[model samples]
Target: MNKITYGRQTISQDDIDEVVKALKSAAITQGEYVPAFENALKEYTGAKYAVAVSSGTAALHTVYAALGLKENDEIITCPNTFAATSNAALYLNAKPKFADINEENFLIDENKINKLITENTKIITPVHYAGLPCNMEEINRTAKSCNIKIVEDACHALGSSYNGSKIGNCIYSDGAVFSFHPVKHITTAEGGAVLTNDEEIYKKCLLFRSHGMEKVNFKHMPDSPTYHEMQFLGYNYRMTDIQAALGISQLKKIESFVKRRLEIADIYYNAFKGSSKIKMQKRYKDRLNSHHLFSVVFESNDLRDKVYYYLKENNIFTQIHYMPVNKHPYYENLGYNYKDTPLAYDFYRRELSLPVYPLLTDDEVYFVIEKINTVLKAL
Candidate 1:
């Protein structure tokens, strides 16, 4: 029996060929492929611009820094997401206020956001959990009312659509971030990107990713083309050309990759639908999920743990989507505990992510479904 993890990357020979070609090139660190990948993402997402970075965390940090988020500012985000969504705000010493999740979809409830807003609120970061887009229409309306900027944590959503528009189009937000981890919809080893329609924000992100340095294309001083200057303090968060090469290749097949994931998800959706003991993420008719994670909420923590361990015992590894960011030890030390976010706490207790990836075999898929059904029946 082969071990099956929650998610895995599907890299083809073409992906390797691209990386090899990039490696043989003269410039690997900052080369043409970097821009190629950025342009591919920009075109794919319908965003006016895209900035590739070292990691999703780097992307978020770059955006937060570019936005000039600093102390005395507050960013409202859900607790039911990765820490980086809110940590980007804390990185600048700004406060990250938690908004509880919607019970049905485990997404940030737009209605809850108004209660958390204050005069100091600067932005609202919404995480598109499990590739299921949050209610961006409502979120956009809420943010616009208070003049708060929106930064979508779209780490799990790549080839997904919302309201007939692509996820990274910035249709309802100022900017959006995507991760290329092995488990996400696509893989560039360790890379991420920020997409935006605003040119000023796009330029800011570009500067922030590369040590705040900009090559002087000074048309006024044709005499000094080599002159470069640091605009401000920044970090080395640039993605390598080698990674970009893989990104470009992988992106070429993203629609197909996402299609496969959704196909696998449909198996789980049908298998578990109408079950009294289990509930899957609710799907919306307005959009398609990238299906990065097919998480199911068991009726109780005990049953969820039982099935989780049972699957592992049978060589089928699983994972938890997340423990609420607020309950993490570091945040708890900062006076954020389970009590701070009730909905997130309740949601986490019953959640477990099953194997969901573009490459999962049909036999393995059916085995997982059978085992889950067996476990639930036993309970």
Candidate 2:
């Protein structure tokens, strides 16, 4: 059997041709394409401002700095996400406190988050895990009571929505970040962006992404007419025109990409609906999932391990969406005990992400389902 991947980027001639055109242009990095790409994303997500950056980690780091996180200042986030979501705060010498996740959707539990808030809590970073929106309404309510800032870690959610609104609208948060990695709903080769309506946060992220230098000339600066000033500490996190060009092209197809993913997810959902050994994540009908991943929970840790290895041996790629961040070696060294977030730790051991992407064919989907059924039968 041929090897099938759990996630992959679907690129086309349009993406290639756009990159070629960018390469031939006189300006590549500082060209008009960068702004054009930012505008395209803003239009798609309805955010007033968007700052494209080199990588998702850079986007998160920029937002963390923009929020004015200081040493020992704490940010609360879920454990069911990639490390970048929480490590962004750690990069600034700030603390990343863990909040348990709802076992149903694998998102930060609003009630758990409410209990974790303290005077040190500066921001509430919620991850829309597996393209499902978090309990944004409740999260927003709780954050308001505590006067904490909100920065959505929307890496897995490009076309997802909550309460009839888009994820990047910043309606319930101060800012939102999206990753354009190959496996994401859209691809920019390797890029990310931060979206916000607040002018201060937008300007902060824009300056922070590019070495804290304001390239646009300001009449207030007395030194020189065209000279730039490095006002704040920053990093080289700017995205190139090549990546921007690809991103613009990819954005045009996001809706179709999301549509196909949802279709595939439906197939998987129906296939395992009545299975005794597996259970599907609960999705609310009011919101539409981008279907970035199709995860299933097994009956036990032993069953999950057996099924995962069996699929791998059969050339069907399978993976765990995450291993609770608090349980990681580094976090463990920080004195984070596994007993703190019992629900999160329990979910992590049995959750599995199966193949679900826009590029996966119908035949391949059937093969994956068949193989899974076979493995379950034997077990």
Candidate 3:
């Protein structure tokens, strides 16, 4: 009966206890909790190395830099993701070429990638949109054949899996990124990480995360204990120990969080299964969705908008996953066209994210389903 949001964090008393301990610790930033959090992530995702950062965007930017993306280099990705996915590449002065999404799954169509590959194409960023794993195995094959790198924009897929492997394992990618924003599956208040198997990439990300300065790998002065070198330009994208402490606690509950999300998604799917006016995202046998959001695609844009307003009026706060990233005013000014990815634009028009957080009670879940069905029947 109260206001229900599409996504939110569920922080336990245990999480608060950890944060309290972190606050009282001597080192809050650049401390033990940071590596502890990274280790937790590595253990969860099966990644050999994990580099925690200030935000998801920073994770992407650091990984892009690590992969040697530079001026005029191109990275192909889907248009249906948050701008951070492509904007990270832009930070390195590299161009982003978008391949359209497959209408069934709302993921990049791997078959469409070859046409976008240029001599300068450096990386293929596959976004696992709405917590559904993209076809990374196929994408990996394409990247290998083209001699390109793969950095998964897995901000929506922290607990998701593909071909029985966890999403951030980096089995099919050079590196994978995960977000720890409040709305994500896990929360560190505001944090993210880069998961990779390559030691060189891991070291580069570590350097990039802290102003490109290293105390050990000093090019100029190796003997002096105080001496450090700024190997290249980098950002101050370090996650604080307090945030890392929160993350460690949250990571422990990820399995339960993702399970609850999937249960909610299944309820929505079954409720709308026979509805002619509403459509659910296609599920694949090979991939496991983390269910960051439970999105429904309506028969028409008008109906989708009507349902959104109706839900809002009934105290349900739904959201749109995204407008096509290329359609934003900033991207438009840069000559990026939304129409180029017609499916993405169409998806944007019809999609509405329903409340699916772990804390959302079953009663609230049924209320959302009932309200949506009621709206459709009225129309």
Model 2 lDDT tens row, 1-379: 5688889999999999999999999888978888999999899989999999998899999999998998999999988889898889989999999988887777888888877889999999999888998888888999999899999999999999988888898999999999999999999989999999999999999899888988775536666667887888999998999889999999999999999999999999999997888888887977778878888899999988988888888898888989888889998998887678888888888998999888898889999889888878887
RMSD after CA superposition, every candidate: 1.5, 1.4, 0.8
TM-score of each: 0.97, 0.97, 0.99
Model 3 Cα lDDT, one tens digit per residue, 168-279:
9999999999999999999998899999999999999999999998878556756667887888898899999999999999999999999999999999988989788988
lDDT of 2 at 295: 85
| lDDT (10s digit) by residue, model 1, range 304-369 | 999998999899999887899989999989888777688789889999999989889888999998
Off by over 4 Å in 2: 216-223
Lowest lDDT block of 10, candidate 1? 216-225
What's the lDDT for all of these models? 0.91, 0.90, 0.93
Best by TM-score: 3
Model 3 clash pairs are: none
Model 2: residue 161 alpha-carbon error in angstroms: 1.0
- After superposing candidate 3, which stretches have Cα over 4 Å from the reference? none
